[model samples]
Target: MSSRIPITLAGLAIVLSTASALYSAHALREQQQLVDHLNGQVARIQPYAFSRSDLDALLSRQSLAVAPPAAPEAPPAPMKRESAPIVGERRYGDATAQFSLIEYSDFECPYCKQYFAVPKAVVDSSRGNASVVFKHVPIHGEASRREAFAAECAAAQGGNDAFYRMAGAIFSSTAGNGTGTEKPLAVIASSIGLDGAALSRCIDNQEPLQKVKADFREAVELGIKETPTTIVRHNPSNRQVVLSGAKGPEDILRAMAKLVQGNGAAQ
Candidate 1:
């Protein structure tokens, strides 16, 4: 019985030793895998590391020795003309009024047709108090020159009311569509109730023709490159504000308000 016990104990000890050997082999494999993974991570990070020489090369390439650009100078203000109100009427109560709006318009410009209500509203609200002037800029075509002349001719016959109505009709017409022809200026003149014979006689008349030319020259002098540019002069003290493009009434009113504030006028 004693000899059997010794053999059993020795066999148990051998089995324990085999189990420990398997565990050690598995542990060694796991450690080796961890080491390899760490090595790969280090390799991946290597390229991102820039040396002192690399930084020096980058600095040399950029050559950080250039001077900064000069600060941009503000553009010169547009010179205001001390000329007469080219066309239309100048009313009283203009001083205490809220705004001064000047419309640079071409009779043939469709955009100008859109803003006919604006001037009417400004003038009506002013009630013979504020000043709203119309300066003709004949840019539509050859016909535009005659039409512009006809407007002044109508003014001569019937005053500003007739002239304003005729001007609006001409702008609203689709005659000047660049197809090499339009409703004759004589037709437009007759349609506006001006004497057709008188309009024909005065078609090429140089008087109204000169007025338009003078307006064009003034526009050029003022750097007005676009039609329907509304210039608002809210105050005598503040510089005049020029709104370019075919702006709506709200935009024009906002601009006028700014000028009025600047000039110490009531909102």
Candidate 2:
């Protein structure tokens, strides 16, 4: 009887140990499943949490996945209207023409250089219908101012024709950006058949500086800021069209046509 009792107690102990081991294993598996479920929920909710760092990271990944955007196109140049009358002394073409192109230019501006011949081209193309007037804006400091004075001095020596000739010589010779020319102003004047010594005297005496300053002040009052600003005015009706920048001859012609058409004149 005693031996049977010992064996029974040993068997009971072994069975209890086996059941505890199985329970522990099952509990471990359930705990692992709960952890996995919690991790999955956190991942799903992370995007909506609005965390800046996480959002930035997501945006970066998206940007890398997509193609870059195309480059933007340049904007068109501006054209506008004004009521200012055409005012300048250096006139080219017929004085009695119906329309006048008043060119406010800088001798040392590259854009002014580009547009040097455009006004003359328009005048020529207009036949007897249009003219041009030159005004000095000399915004490129002393070099431009000196050139303006020299051209005016040519006018003083010769007349309107000499002024235009001097202007042409300067425009043709200058390297732009305040560099007047490789040749001296007087030399350029002589080359153009003006009295170079007299022109130099005129410049030294500052005879034409006031004319340049007046033009600049007039431009300021009219709100003209950029180089190569052209004012197309109809002498008959006092209608004005302002063109800013280095516009081609065609652009001026087109503006002229529009003005003529508006006035019920023949094309």
Candidate 3:
């Protein structure tokens, strides 16, 4: 090799080493500040367009807003009650309710867990005029898929009541945006009075996989890219309103009331 070749290679090595060191320093600095990490991530990909401060403010507001507990022994409400019937959906409230809230949720989605009860109270307060429909959108991974199927298996054993019970237990026990485990699934089933052996067999078979997949397919078709995407319908006029993230009860109710009032005025 030429005498100059060695010098060139050494120079290239020094440059690369310097660049790598700078990147490491930048990453470490970013990681050290939780606030910066969140803001940077959102600035990169999230369309929410909110700063980290904005999200923190929202969370603080939610924490201040007290939420009521679900009924201790209530069965899963009902499913697919609209004019267009869905064969296996798990639902709550009256089939003939004047208002409907269709929630596209994932078992492992913490946001869904956080916002689960807003519409429940709305439906309850509606005095048989509103209903809530639950759709399976297992976005996390295999564990999420398993939890979704376990819910369906609960339905198979005891119908929609079992399904909602299992779902409620799972959502209540969920820690964060993470996968679920078999022990919790079985425990929730057993607690809800489902046949343990039957649930295990059903989960093992994975037949409910296709059932969950169908709901996810529909969600994708509807441009629903997030969990807890709630589509509240003013049934009489067929108007729809969408809410994403952990929306509070007052916000949802106000939105629903506005839609109803606006539609009524129009008619």
Candidate 4:
């Protein structure tokens, strides 16, 4: 039975190794969670950290003067809320809130990925004052469109929370401006604890795709020519500021401050 003792000891050692590895992994994950939480708080405070001169220079670089609507007759996109659920069903903040910030972006666009941080900062700063809206302008063709569909499906299944989680996954996994592959996209759906089989069915249907397409059509109509476009408006006042291209945290907050101050964009 001496041989049996050695085999038993080997098996016990393997078990201990695996248990140690799992515990280490769990500890690392917890540490990561704490770090991410602290970082978010720090990032939220960063926007307000700039001085007036710094903000002015940033705004000047942004050409703080927004361009006039291309056509006075054709309504500018994202500017009007006559259309309810402006960002569709996936939204954050008090539904009855008076301020609105809209971001038009593509899943495959790296700049768009970076700007995703803007909404949280704005919404957090606004507190009960502002609402964030997400508009899909998936410009990288079918692959991007597929990713958009996946996000919508997640929303359909688990509402706005799940939608954001899936987006975080897409933006985090996708490299450069490169597209995320189908398998990774599927994995994202599953990671969010969404129904993967149903997501597949939904993507196959493509009927829900109309929501994103409509946003695209409206963007074209508004002459919103690029990804990472931001539209900030204060309700009742209805003042607006439309910013195109990727913006630094200072740039976006200052632009948004125009709406919050009820100044709107300079005419």
Name the runs in model 4 displaced over 4 angstroms: 1-87, 176-178, 265-267
Worst 10 residues of 2 by lDDT: 50-59
Error of 1 at 61 (Å): 47
lDDT-better candidate, 2 vs 4: 2
Cα deviation in Å at residue 7, candidate 4? 99
**C-alpha-based local distance difference test score of model 2:** 0.72
- Which of 3 and 4 is ahead in lDDT? 3
Over 129-208, each residue of candidate 4 has an lDDT whose tens digit, in order, gives 66778887766656677788888877877778888888877787776344566465667788779888777777666635
Candidate 2 residue lDDT tens string, 46-162: 221111111111111211111344655976454231212222499889999988899988788777877878788767756577888998877665788789888888888777899
Question: What residue runs in model 1 are displaced by over 4 Å at the alpha carbon?
Answer: 1-98, 126-129, 175-182, 263-267
Model 2 residue 122 CA deviation in Å: 1.0
lDDT of 1 by residue, 127-170 (tens): 44235667766665555566677777767666776777777667
Q: Least lDDT summed over 10 consecutive residues: which range in candidate 4?
A: 51-60
Residue runs of model 2 more than 4 Å from their true location after superposition: 1-88, 263-267
Candidate 1 matches the true fold with a TM-score of 0.57
Question: CA lDDT of 41 in candidate 1?
Answer: 36
What TM-score goes with each of the models? 0.57, 0.65, 0.64, 0.65
lDDT of all the models against the reference?
A: 0.57, 0.72, 0.68, 0.66
